[model samples]
Target: MFRLSSLIGCTVLFLISCGTSKKSFVMPSAENISAVKFLGEYDIPYNLLYKNTVVGGLSGIDYDKKNDCYYFICDDRSDNNPARFYKAKIFITPHGIDSAVFTDTRSLLQPDNTVYPNKKQDRLHVPDPEAIRYSPVLNQLIWSSEGERIVKEKDTILANPAVTSIGLDGSFKHSFELPANLTMHATENGPRQNGVLEGMSFANNYKTLFVNVEEPLYEDGPRADITENNAFIRILKFDVASRKNTAQYAYKLEPVAYPANPANAFKINGIPDILNIGTDKFLVIERSFSTGRAACTIRVFITDLHNATDIKNIASLKGNSSFVPATKKLLLNMDDLGIYIDNVEGVTFGPVLPNGHKTLVFVADNNFEKAEKAQLLLFEITE
Candidate 1:
């Protein structure tokens, strides 16, 4: 039983509400966080170079300083009947993109390149992946595939994404079955096109797995009007031992109206990634899409997620600008970027520079476009 002093109106209380499985679940509290600053940009730049892009897009990103270079994954595949996975090296800077080169160019396809052993039926045109991370401590690149197909139809389980560990050479070293309940999510708006759980980042010194929900399944009601409740982001912390999500932190990406959209036309967005921006402070990439437009901008919130376990209503994020960074500077549109890809998928923190300042890095999912480019943007922050 947890009692919270209402920061909004009357004193609201929070109690353990039972879950679908008869489990006790307590909702976090409502918080009034203030807006923050960008702290300027960390200077790292990168570009995308690939032989084929029928693979479509790249979603998640991770940096492995152990090898002195940054790594990323692409869910889109070559246009062949049997598609394959692609990867690249991202070098980024604050100014813009520098270069992105695809390496370990291989195929997830089998002999005759016609079988996807991961699934039994329904040939995959290409896998729509949303998450990817490299664990230097583990010497392995961990990634999550948001899109997977099944022939039996009955085998449909909200999300059955796989967590594969790839070697330095882009070879599969270890593959683990991700707990469906903890990793995968159901797309709500389009009943036919369901977007599964895709965001992946490692935190707690690489001890806990932070998995976030992009959007909810059919539960989103209707996409009639641009509403606040539609924006959702859940951060799931996994305990390697129990192999279960130790903590589930869910929050609504609150909408803020800036000079860009005077009618308050813009909706709130969720965290594409989270990091320890400062010594004790954390920064979450709060993002959202613009209506009738292809571009989107994401703001930064330097809040204490450890203390944020109390945020209740997602719509309540309005007026919390003190905790969020400046708007319209990070991006003009979500789908459109200064680079080839507007879909910037993953983000992670790199090692501390020799000067003692920390480096913040972001990676873009190329959507595997021959013309489009995958980018890795790096920034040096003075905390």
Candidate 2:
């Protein structure tokens, strides 16, 4: 019976249906994703920028460009109660890369290998971690544990791959295991279907370890998964001295017109842009959560890894290409790199750019935030 202009038009139609129902993570008009001109696109120009960040942001990043400095980790628990134990290392510059002043603290996750043996076995106690890398002849430190929960659909959360050797002063040497189920399938459609694995890279001396699996999550319009297939790129290969699984390659992310169906492709989800680019060549980072753009594609393989038989297979390789007419064509198209990420979880490759070619980096793992949003997007692969 109230008629104050019909109670302000029913409170303006209840605030326009609560603002179209809480979906504003930035879908502006669908294909309007931009973030690759930095100060030119994102505008972080202040003195050219570069100050701190030794271990304040990193959800998943792995770099061992023969040793320039990189082996970071930050999945969460500094205050959430796992107690607090993040890994670290940083200080490489061309323009952006900082995180190294760590006199030495010691907390690289450890619950008990010896339970702390003497307090240095690379320490321990981790969960829901993202990614990290480094192997030098078996020096150790090749991890991955992309674990997350809360599903109404398909559920089968399986992610486990670890190995530590710890030394540099933090201590911890020789931890093992990485080969059995091999993990990272993505979906069959049930529990909480998955496209999970978390990016990683290492082949020069890390024996062999290249894993990246994130691609799954759609609304049907980002290009519509081309049409709709399944969503793939398992590409596993772990030996690291008999850890097993010498080969296993799965590639399915060739979206074009749609209906590609591995099951209906489109779920690299995010965070995995690995790189090795040499012998069997490797440099994978294809992000396009529906045309938002983010690709570093380049994977030429014929693996034999000396002999490991299971080269699984991933032959023809070469980077991504397509950005018609140039000028970002419509706010989305990648050549070598593109960053304006909302969900770019991890990528690694460093050292060798003086006309030699090689220095690509990327990290984004905000899942430590649940819905997702923790960034560390860096780039370089020129020459």
Candidate 3:
């Protein structure tokens, strides 16, 4: 009887120990991050040519930890060259960003084992590459393309946005089955032109995937302007193993930063990229550009889905307020930095610094224009 009683006591103690361990384990979150200090900026010369391809339109960037290098996707749309990504070695020091050297370039392949053709060649498959992330778990690189949506009186070229996995060598792997709402339609019912699948990141130890749109869908609401403050964009969650979008949440965008030059030019504000800091928490980049403005307004915000309602099943968010959107807190604004910020579109967490603080990097899209510059900015995270 004593032996049985001792055994039972040991089992109870073990159970209590397990419970304590579980309770003590705290998940890492954006709350732990306090602020970020600007480190330095590096600008790649305009119209730099490498491997016979123009090195511009660097809209998306990701760092490969194992290789200690960076991959930048060029949103050339096959106009200058075949749709491609470039690998480079960026040198970062305590003082600031030293320089970036191009190492290699690879053409992103299609399922047909051919590179994406330009619009004049094949209007249906012209890829507008935007965001990219390197997955150590899958040992592959995942990229997003905001597919074309052109509707002419006689010619309609519509291609669905895509999130595809590719081998490290840039070979096509597979694609995730996107939700139905992402479909492109000629009418005003689906994603707006050049607004789908702007940014993506892996979360939950690469088990879950998150991709966001550049703007609100037609059914969601009207685009962000000087008057509207209720434009809602969707952040989609995908189960990596299943390669399917599982859930989605709505995120409201701020109004346009500034009015257009002629009061009706081009003005826009939307999420351009996002990075996962912890469980359901992300660092989002909201880029605002107004016509006739010399530079863009770039802001970094940290958001979480702790109390956000899942809006995956909801058809439209035009006038709906029944669901709570993700909670957001501003982290940084480039305007306050007193520096000219370009069209900054990409954000990613870099390697830790010697002081043990984390590093964050942002890259700008030059649009292959001589007027704009391909810029890279570095920041050190403060706890």
Candidate whose lDDT is highest: 3
How big is the positional error of residue 205 in model 3, measured in Å on the Cα after superposition? 0.6
RMSD of 2: 19.6
Ranking the candidates on lDDT from highest down gives 3, 1, 2
Predicted model with the maximum TM-score: 3
Stronger candidate by TM-score (1 vs 2): 1
Candidate 1, 204-255: lDDT as tens digits: 5555566655543333222212444434344556654344555544445555
Task: State every prediction's TM-score relative to the real structure.
Answer: 0.60, 0.27, 0.92
Off by over 4 Å in 2: 1-71, 74-130, 133-140, 143-210, 213-225, 228-234, 242-245, 254-341, 344-383
Query: lDDT scores for all predictions?
Result: 0.47, 0.43, 0.89
RMSD of each: 14.1, 19.6, 5.5
Question: Candidate 1: global Cα-lDDT?
Answer: 0.47
Q: By TM-score, how accurate is candidate 1?
A: 0.60
State which candidate, 1 or 2, has the greater lDDT: 1
Q: List the residue pairs that clash in candidate 3.
A: none
TM-score of 3: 0.92
lDDT of 2 by residue, 1-383 (tens): 77899999999999999988854221001011122222111111221212222233354555544545566665543333231124335554556555443332334545342222211222223244456665554445655554443333554333333444454433456544544343333443211223445666666445566665554323111221554554434456666566555665444454542122354444333325555545545545554453333332222121222322232433211121111110101222333344345555555554543444344455544443434444454444322
